[model samples]
Target: MLSGFFRLEYQNRTVLGEWKKVHWLKWKVSIGLSTIN
Candidate 1:
């Protein structure tokens, strides 16, 4: 039971990391576009 809980937490952390990366990329793209315009 403890192992299962740990695994679930790990999965959530990885997913959150990916989500942050996506948002970071989108932010950079928007900044670039704004500078160009």
Candidate 2:
């Protein structure tokens, strides 16, 4: 039972990490475009 809980927590962390990375990349791209214009 403890192992299952740990696995769920790890999965959530990875999912959140990926979500943040995607948002960060999008923000960088938007900034670059604004600067270019």
Candidate 3:
């Protein structure tokens, strides 16, 4: 049971990390576009 809980936690972290990465990429793109304009 403890192992399962840990696994779920790990999965959540992985998903959160991916989400943050996507947002960060989008943020960088917006900044680049603003500078160009």
The Cα local distance difference test for each model comes to: 1.00, 1.00, 1.00
lDDT of 1 by residue, 1-37 (tens): 9999999999999999999999999999999999999
TM-score of 3: 0.97
lDDT (tens digit, per residue) of candidate 3 on 1-37: 9999999999999999999999999999999999999
Q: Per-residue lDDT for 17 in model 1?
A: 100
- Between prediction 1 and prediction 2, the one with superior TM-score is 1
Every model's TM-score: 0.97, 0.96, 0.97
Model 2's number of clashes is 0
Model 1 CA deviation exceeding 4 Å by range: none
Query: Which 10 successive residues of model 1 have the least lDDT summed?
Result: 1-10
Reference-based TM-score, model 2: 0.96
Give per-candidate clash totals.
Answer: 0, 0, 0
In the range 1-37, model 2's lDDT, one tens digit per residue, is 9999999999999999999999999999999999999
